[model samples]
Target chain A: MAKSGHRTPRTALTCALSLAHGLPIGWCVLPITHFPFLLVSSAYNGCKRIHKEGKVMTFRSLYHTEVINDAGLNGHARVTLGGDFDVLTSSPLQDDPGTNPEQLLGLALATCLNATIEAEEGRRGLEHAAEVKVGVDMGKDTEGYQFFLDCQVRIPQVAEAEAQEILAKCERRCPVAKIVGSSQNVRVHLVKQFAF
Target chain B: MAKSGHRTPRTALTCALSLAHGLPIGWCVLPITHFPFLLVSSAYNGCKRIHKEGKVMTFRSLYHTEVINDAGLNGHARVTLGGDFDVLTSSPLQDDPGTNPEQLLGLALATCLNATIEAEEGRRGLEHAAEVKVGVDMGKDTEGYQFFLDCQVRIPQVAEAEAQEILAKCERRCPVAKIVGSSQNVRVHLVKQFAF
Candidate 1:
């Protein structure tokens, strides 16, 4: 038996100072790096080529989503994933195992919302506690699927008038929320093989 | 030269149904997918290789931050980016080339305050806008450099009474914000060269 021979490449950082009002502020930068491949003993008693490009590997993953309730018009809603009643799996096949689309969509939507809210909040000067509740409704057309997102946010502390102004600004500025609420078409291809 | 190939893989989809108290709920299941690979035409004779595990192909990606600035913090109150001045020759790097970190921090603090006020205003089931602002103070350390983060959040429609509770919940929920605020032991090694 031999070792797995796992290695992780690291980076060296370089720093300089930028002047601000006659004061020096620090600036940090990391340079791009390259690594050489080496050969040692292998479990198969052979030398194998190791790819050293500093890139995260792409995996072929899949996801299955089933919207229990569309919340067609009413404001309140709930959605579930997995178990029976799976809309993504019609014909049962050995190769067909559902990927976690619910989790992925949730993650993507959450990250996007986080970015949008942060950007908008940065533009305004208000510090307090904030919470966002995102609700997604999926619809279908001749093309594929469309997601309707309704986000409700709770900000604790501040005057009524100021909150309205910030809310308007956030609606216009948050990219992810805007994308979900926009008229731009998002295409989801139905494929036997899954790729991003 | 051979033409590049764009192959559309086959996608399979299925659906199932269940009744909750005689109400039918639907679910959709789809296959697992791989993360998309970048196509740098010149890299591999007009083709690109899939990034290996743990490697990131893209150099610059968006990061979410939440910053907080208490009132009466003078001088250092302003938030700016790209080194206060053009001291760092690398201008127009991304979003705001002339962004001041200090100014950004100040604005983030203000935004957090504003969100709370707004959330309070959007009473009666209306959705209010919410946001978080992040400011990082990067400086040289004995080992390398350190980044001090300040998080400010604003929820446009929160009542004053509920402010503390909401803020605490948000602190725990936001993923990127949580990682930065709680995780202080993240480490990275700097290697001059790789020999294995």
Candidate 2:
């Protein structure tokens, strides 16, 4: 075991070197590099698929997500992207044109809201036991895009005002909701479009 | 505009041709097929970086995302693989070693519970505004491995009995929770590791 002591140049170097080599921290704390078999044996193997196509492109986007609470429960709602732009698709569903990116974005936002509720309930030390319903509204124009997500959550024996506070907190904590609410410019490289 | 009937064939043929010619989706969609121009516009710039790296590897991962509802409000929750077994780091957190995967898996189960809530809420017209919370538990015993996810949802102004029934129904609807709840084998492969 390495003893706790004053900071030393040697220790810093060791830490840096270990990190640089992608070595596990456990092995780094103890000097055992000479044992090739042990080092090799300890390595964890995992495959990662890399995308090779597409130039890194800088673009502006806003992601919208929502949460809904109703029927004595809470739920979620959402939409993503900075502006309301339809995903140009030739497919048409009956009289209605096939779903657009906006529509898909709606679904994504709904999911994000649901995720928020689950995370928050856990934070509150509550067991996972409830149902949710979600809805989203996207208002787009030259002024920009505004996404409103509403949800109804089903829980046992909670007052209306208390439930409202919980839903508000959930919105505040939701990562996806926060990202979109902040309206930060997300940097994403346009990758190859998947052929349908 | 081209008639709807002809669009599918043309799009498929065009995609096939683009692949054969090593052209990116951006080029395929463009009216002009000049190679240089095509490469520049494709999403992710035609995977050039991916090509520069030699060898190919595959990474299999499942992300569990969920939405939660309490009453007329909504929230969201999710647990990811990175949260649990982040083996890429040189210094692994001493609190938990290799079992991070189990926590992440537990998070997935919890997220599935959120999904169940969302689905159930959708089924019941009462779902409106909602909030959600989640909890995850993971442990290993002589039997093998065990993962448990618990969620708590808040629904304002709803009866307790109704909330319990919805929770039961939602539990049945969650897919990720069910899969993780079942026995399955998980494996990982090692690709080239790089130091930051």
What interface root-mean-square deviation (Å) does model 2 yield?
Answer: 20.7
Candidate 2 wrong stretches, greater than 4 Å: A1-98, A123-134, A137-140, A143-157, A182-196, B1-196
Candidate 1's TM-score reads: 0.23
TM-score of 2: 0.24
lDDT of each: 0.26, 0.29
- Report the lDDT tens digits of candidate 1 across residue range B16-66: 111222221221221113323342211122111112222212111111111
Task: Residues B65-86, candidate 2: write the lDDT tens digits.
Answer: 1122232122222112111111
Most DockQ-accurate candidate: 2
Candidate 1, superposed: residue stretches over 4 Å from native:
A1-103, A119-125, A184-196, B1-196
Best by TM-score: 2
Q: Tell me how each candidate scores on DockQ against the true complex.
A: 0.02, 0.04
| Per-prediction share of native contacts kept | 0.01, 0.05
Q: What local lDDT does model 2 show for residue B159?
A: 71
Tell me how much of the true interface, by contacts, candidate 2 captures.
0.05
